[model samples]
Target: MLGTIIITIFILGPVGVLSQSAENNSISERIIGGHSAAEGQFPYQVSIRVNGKHECGGSIISSFWILTAAHCVARYPLGVLLVVVGTNHVKLGTPYGVAQVFVHEQYESQTKINDIGLIKLAGRINFNAKIKPIQLSTSLQPPGTSCVLSGWGFTNVQTQTIPDSLQYIGMRIVSVERCRAAISAAGLNMPVVDTQVCAFNAPGRGACNADSGGPLVCNGVQYGIVSWGNPCATGVPDVFTSVAANRKWIAIKSGV
Candidate 1:
């Protein structure tokens, strides 16, 4: 049951307003209530930059491929995007030019379904203790399962600026029914489909703007891609694109 909900998408990579559906909601960026990550702690984490700015978070699924939200790269062209890896600090990573982008064919900006996307780097990444690829999840984690989300997104939504150092927080997966109910209670008329997963822990702690396209790792496997949610972790469950649900599509597109 889809209803009209105000979706504040944290679209950090793109520089302009995204007109999704009739609402035409504004897009911003961040991660709320998180802490600084240690060096090499999240080796698969990466910063998706546009025009030399850190705009979105991504994961290194392969030496030549990165996985992120379709919204992060869907609206922009190839030349403007760059991927940086191998560092916890956003400014001190190895940069790679994008060669190709593969957004899900059925991605819908309004509904935020099938929000996965892939990036093929112009050159291969050199793996080290500080840089590596993450394994894709083959199954959906049950509700209440603990997971870690890492990114260089904004620590505060009001500031609307990304942090130089990577940030991470522990969150727990919630049932789709609970997610839908929470969104409805929050006055958002958006549907939480099976292709999407929801995670939440407390009211003030959750994914915010600029946290989009980041990885949700459970048991060391990447299971979700940060998609959309209430602004700055206002306790409303944060939604993500289920990597397990889109594994085949990812393999077909990137062969990773």
Candidate 2:
């Protein structure tokens, strides 16, 4: 009945990472209403740096590959992007140069469709207690299932600065039908395709600026990629790239 809703509501725009903080307070102002993660809590979490600063978050899917939103790296050259793993704090890890960057061939920058991308590390990442690859899910998770989203993004949209350590929050998946209804009620005219998943955003709980390209994990599996949503965790559902929908694309690009 609502098949057409997917064509009419919510095609997300480029979602930025948590903004860089002032010279001071760079590491303590992370995700909105979230808490700090312990070391190895999310071993696959990665910070995607550009020109030596944390610009976005990503997930390690294999020793030599990372999965992130294409919009995060589409504009930057390969030389400027560095993938850092094995650390919970943003600036504490060694930066590995990217050997190659692959944006999905069908990525639509205008609407954020097929927003996934991959990075081939210049050198293989060594796995340790604090660094490892996350498994990718091949099935769709039902709505209302709890998932964990971790990133180093802004805690407040108005402020637009990030925390020192990685932050995480538990969120629930919103049904596609309900998500479309909410966007329609909000008067936002965009598309929500099969490749996208929507996560519920309660007050003070949601991905904000600078949280893009991070991993959205469920049952310890990489199920979603942080894509876009209402600024500042407003009471609207945040959208992600459904990993299960694009698993083949990831496998081909990552060779994992």
Best by TM-score: 1
Top lDDT model: 1
lDDT of each candidate versus the true structure: 0.77, 0.72
Provide TM-scores for the models. 0.90, 0.87
lDDT score for candidate 2 against the true structure: 0.72
Compute the lDDT of residue 205 as modeled in candidate 2: 66
Q: Which 10-residue window of candidate 1 scores lowest in summed lDDT?
A: 13-22
Q: Residue by residue across 61-123, what tens digits does model 1's lDDT show?
A: 998999998888898899889999999887889999999999999999887889889999999
How many collisions per candidate? 7, 13
The residue ranges of model 1 lying beyond 4 angstroms of the native Cα positions read 1-29
lDDT of 2 by residue, 1-256 (tens): 0000111122122121223111211111125778889988999999998888787888999889999888778888999889889998988986799999999999987667898899999998899899989999899999988888888887655555678888888878887777766554444545568899887637556776567788888888888887766444545567788999999988887777
